[model samples]
Target: MTEITTAQPRSLTTALDIPRPPDLSWYVQARQPVGYEVNLTRGLLNPDNPALARSVGADGYTSVRTLVVVDKVVDGLYGKALRAYFDAWRVDARWKVMPGDEDTKNLEQAVEVTAAMTEMGILRRTEKVVVVGGGVLMDVVGLAASLYRRGAPYVRVPTTLVGQVDAGVGVKTGVNHGTHKNRLGTYFAPEITLIDPEFLRTVEPRHIANGLAEIIKMALIKDASLFRLLEETVAGIDGDALADCGPAMGEVVSRAIAGMLDELEPNLWEWVLERSVDYGHTFSPSLELRADPPLLHGEAVAVDMAVCVALAVGRGLLSQADAERALGLMVAARLPIAHPVFTPELLEVGLADAVKHRDGLQRLPLTNGIGDCVFVNDVTGDELRRALEFVHAYAGTRDGVRDGS
Candidate 1:
């Protein structure tokens, strides 16, 4: 008579390990710690600033070689200044200018940027790519830098209001693909990001409004004080006011940046699909790409946020008065609360796509109240239809002015 016993497996040593037979499987694990700075400065291209020059780890005595990928519009405005700054710092910079609009965010544009890097003989590790433009340009060049030699260092100098406050501060690089916004993208951190509010002076009023929408998203989902500040100062806030960097705008920028960083730092790779920062993003991607005139990124987001607010109210997660105030703030900021393109069919399609993107659940972020958020996975088609109808009626009360009017 023989008694048989099974052997116990040894304990796993790594986070990614499976407790399988060593002879049958192998496992390895590694963690990459990403650290980067988002610096707020004025006149970044001024030769005397030294902020941009120092970011590349350059001293005054030695000449550094680097590639600069800039948006054509930004280049037109600051090319000479950038040239003089580099020349003064004894740095050799190769300039690659490309169009930086929503329409131009694509794989081809990213390839063009990579080609420019190759032509300039970019050093994979030692030298860095400087991206100067709005969110679109940053995404394109960031993707290019990420693809070059598998991974190359890059710096972001976001020139638009959206760039300074939202896109420029984050580590996501993406381009729209075939009618899908940010369908193709990568999570690549920049070496550093320089934000200059002074750049906003030349931005159009409409674009300024576009940027404010993102700030509002932060307010609704994270900071009640920020929402109050926006309510108080939105009447006087414009591109010029933001460029001036006065007390109100400065606080707005500071809080928005801090709030965004707070939400992002904890979950940079988004291993957790539930996110408060995704409040307005759930449906905006589809609407942004489908609009006839092409709504700006923030404009699309505003419409989505409005609908989500209405959804929250219907669910009793937010007060009716709070919903009105939130929608009112969007109008005051000159952002769109409703659009013709955001139809019931589009809502269904967007939710379907979002479910796929969020790992087989809606995970839709809705404002529970001012400065708070909740995710709902069980949102039905009827609910979305009612929300859309509510948004349209709310927009009508504003003297028949809709988005793009």
Candidate 2:
């Protein structure tokens, strides 16, 4: 008689035809971006994402503006396991939690949260903080950290897949305005990013899928081989295997994220950040902005990819067949190809806002071909409107060709 151990990590095999040897040098910073403190725990899955403080060994500096949230999730940092981390270290903390506060991926709430922390003098320079939940917590807490003391050190322990793969790695952090996602934010990097795959075992499936969407975006935009790896094995893979990306696909992704952030690191004020808009976001952020409650930043970005794919076809940037190849992959993964409830008014609003928010200085990048894309801010109102209408029709299934674009 044999028994499978319950604690064994899952595994899968799908060979990706990587064409070029990855440049290991791309990851090396001339001067380290900044020193970080990461605490990765073994066996025990804790609710708090910031494991660095515990791993820092000795009593590190207490946070001036510790943005604490009242989390009742037994699976999150707000739960009992986090108390154990504090107990292990035996450090006393002055923290407060406000109940009944709904968590939103919105900026208004972020502003309010930051103001409350500032008023309490909980946020200050020289002290570091710990943000406890998923991406929303990171976005709000990170923004608060950046604003307080004009900037303070904070560590992130991402509790969700969406947070780990995308938001958690990138230096970008922000709060949404009205319907616009991340309209208010900064390029502040964290003091450390801790990943505890144990926490992901408790994540909901839809959230995991959303995180995969961002990962796919990075793959599709940069490497065909990586996209193939995701397309072939995403579904059958267990939750922990997905989170174990530390070995599976973490390096390639880290480089891409590092590259993307480096492009903005030099221009933190966003003076040149728009130089990398890369087509998918123009409509994506607009859809997010036009959303009354604002769309999930990732969801809106998925829909934006649809709009850009169609425009790529219209502008002779991408061949119809190539566009279909990308579309098929997204559909196979069950991602939203278009916004089902999007309207003409909403589309117009989204596009106009994207254009208004940008400087006329340069055009953003759009995929013109495989492993290669282009940026030309010359996108016209007519072409952009048509792209939106196509998205509208496709998502509604009004024309049974949503993925066709």
Candidate 3:
């Protein structure tokens, strides 16, 4: 027994291949139907109407409270009035005001918001959290709602045009982490998204143009009619014009909202890699986060879209005239079509990251014309460099005009 030497374990090549019933072959699947309304209304915060209470589910239960996380700017503008409105409806409410800007949107801010909601004792499935602000606050607080006790009901009252038309309409919520745009996030739909054009009245002019960038993206990728509408009305879209919500502006918002819904609703979880909606997003994230002044989300997207247009033109998938028209719309909207941060090296890094994100292939969506898209996996690093240079030269011409040179 002592000399057995543990049976010498086993010979190096003694065992033959023996396969058993392969661990019970199976797959798991589920379907969760998430439906939310993105309502575009005016005067949403008016105390005379009980719509806010109804929208937040405060009218459904007396014991429940609507935990309101408001952007600092929104709070300054309507905080007292909002509190009075909630009180008039005899609805219990708690308000927490936080700064809502790209720089402030982070994991700590999200955690802070979640902690405040936690202190309010909101019920997971019943009581609602109301996030009132621009895109940044919506993202930060929406992320909080998604994390608290696993998931909680929330309503979005988008106060900015960008919030109403783009960020608020989608289910994705996120905050930047370590120089990465939306590095940590989750896709959690809101119970309702209340969009009031009235809020745009107080927004700065530059912000209005920021919102138009996303709409332009939708038009270029999927809706020719939308592209035409934008071409028809781009000159009239001043900051004040958006606030007025005239017929033209209404159609723009409606069509953009509808287009976004059409693209996003079918694949809310973003299971598809060749997403038309990712046309500008592939390169914008890095440009947005790494810029010296930290360019606005849509500004970076506009620049990225310009580069993609150049890439498409180079491939002969899009005509030079069509590319100019697409880019001209961005210029007419007063959106920046290029930035110094969008150098060849930076763009290459963004494209490489996007390739990884798209599951090891470049699922780059290029325009076939102004309104159709084709996903290509064959974009080379040289093509990306040339595209960046093309956008830079084009933007120089546009900037010269703005500078009155």
- Please tell me which predicted candidate would have the highest TM-score against the true structure: 1
Computed on alpha carbons, the lDDT of every model, listed in order, comes to 0.91, 0.59, 0.86
Error of 3 at 336 (Å): 1.4
TM-score for each model: 0.93, 0.73, 0.90
> By the TM-score metric, which is better: model 1 or model 3?
1
Between the candidate structures 1 and 2, which one is better when assessed by TM-score? Answer: 1
Name model 3 segments beyond 4 Å from true: 1-28, 60-64, 400-405
Best by lDDT: 1
Instruction: Encode model 1's per-residue lDDT on 1-405: one tens digit a residue.
Output: 899999887656544565556546747999999999999998888888999998886787899988988889988988999999999998888888889998999999999988988888888899989999999999999898889899999999998999998999989999989878888999999999999998999899988988999999999999999999999999999878998999999999999999999999999999999989998999999998988788899999999999999999999999989999999999999888888878998999999999999999999988878999888999999999999998888888873235444
**Candidate 2 per-residue lDDT over residues 42-94, each given as its tens digit:** 44333243344443332545422243443335233435656555655554433
Least accurate stretch of 10 residues (summed lDDT) in model 1?
A: 14-23
Candidate 1 lDDT score relative to the true structure: 0.91
Model 3: per-residue Cα lDDT at residue 284: 92
> Can you write out model 3's per-residue Cα lDDT over 1-405, one digit (the tens) per residue?
467555566644446333346643557999888988888777777766666888766553464578899998889988988888888776788889999989998999999988887788778787889999999999999899899998998999998878988999999999988978888999999989988888888888888888999999999999999999999999888767887889898888899999989999888998887899998999999888877776778888888899999999999999988988988888998888877667788888998999888899989999989889999988888998889777777777785122211
lDDT of 1 at 52: 96
Prediction-by-prediction clash tally: 0, 12, 0
Residue range with the least summed lDDT across 10 consecutive positions in model 3: 396-405
Q: Which stretches of candidate 2 lie over 4 Å from their true place?
A: 1-51, 54-78, 96-126, 244-268, 277-279, 289-295, 388-405
